[model samples]
Target: MTVLLIALGAALGAPLRYLTDRAVQARHGSPFPWGTLTVNVAGSLLLGGLLAAPVDPAVTALVGTGFCGALTTWSTLSYETLRLARTGKRRLAYANAALSVAAGLGAAFLGYALVTALTG
Candidate 1:
């Protein structure tokens, strides 16, 4: 049961992530990989909100473990950063790492706070 729910969530999440990455990359011209950053932060924010809310374990498993896991690609982020450095965009690579960490944290915190306030 749990596995099925998680799988279902991942099925939706993976494609959504791909589409979002495509759209963002197309809009930004693919220099800084705004797509990866956008998805990571968005996934973090969504996970934070879902966790903070009074939801069941199955809900957490499906959305947090599966959806967010599928939606956010740490491997891609690392690879893109490496590619940027290898291609001589070292500054952009560093910036990507820094921004991903900082913005991911900020979005999670903000999401948690917002959900808590709204629920309260």
Candidate 2:
């Protein structure tokens, strides 16, 4: 049941993530990997909210363990940053890395706070 829920969530999350990434990339044009950053930040916030919510275990498994896990792509972010660095865009690469980590964490914290305030 847990595996099934995760699989279902992942099915939805992966395509959503892909579409979002493409849309952002289409608008922004990816010399900077804005898509991955956007998704990661968004996913972090979502996961935080899910965590803070008084949801059932199954829902948590679906959203946090599955959806969010699929929606965010740290590996892709790292690859893009490394690719940027390898291509001599060291400054942009570092900025991307720093901003993604910092802002992702901040967004997660903010989401958690918001959910906590609402629920509490």
Candidate 3:
């Protein structure tokens, strides 16, 4: 049952992430990869919230491991950064790498803090 729930959550997360990335990229119209950045930060925030919540293990597995694991993609971010560097967008590549890591962490921390405030 846990496995099935995880799978179901991942199924929903993956396509949702894809569509979000596409939409954000379409709006941005640049190689900056705003789409991936958005998803990564958002996913981190969600996972952080779930971790702090008093939810069941199955719920954590589904939302944290399955959904967030698929939704937040380090691989894609790395690939995009590399592709940018390879294509001579060294400045943008560096900015993307730095900003994504920093902002993602901040977002996660904020989510955890929010949960703490509410639950405490």
Tell me each candidate's RMSD, in Å, in order. 0.8, 0.9, 0.7
**Candidate 3 per-residue C-alpha lDDT over 22-44 given as tens digits, one digit per residue, 9 for 90 to 100:** 99999986889999999999999
- Residue range 1-120, candidate 1, lDDT tens digits: 999989988998999999999999999865899999999999999987987899999999899988999999999999999999999999999999999999998999988999999998
Per-residue C-alpha lDDT of model 2 across residues 78-97, encoded as one tens digit per residue: 99999999999999999999
Give the Cα error of residue 106 in candidate 1, in Å: 0.4
lDDT of model 2 at residue 58?
99
Off by over 4 Å in 2: none
Worst 10 residues of 2 by lDDT: 28-37
List TM-score per model, in order: 0.97, 0.97, 0.97
Tell me the whole-model lDDT of each prediction, alpha carbons only. 0.93, 0.93, 0.93
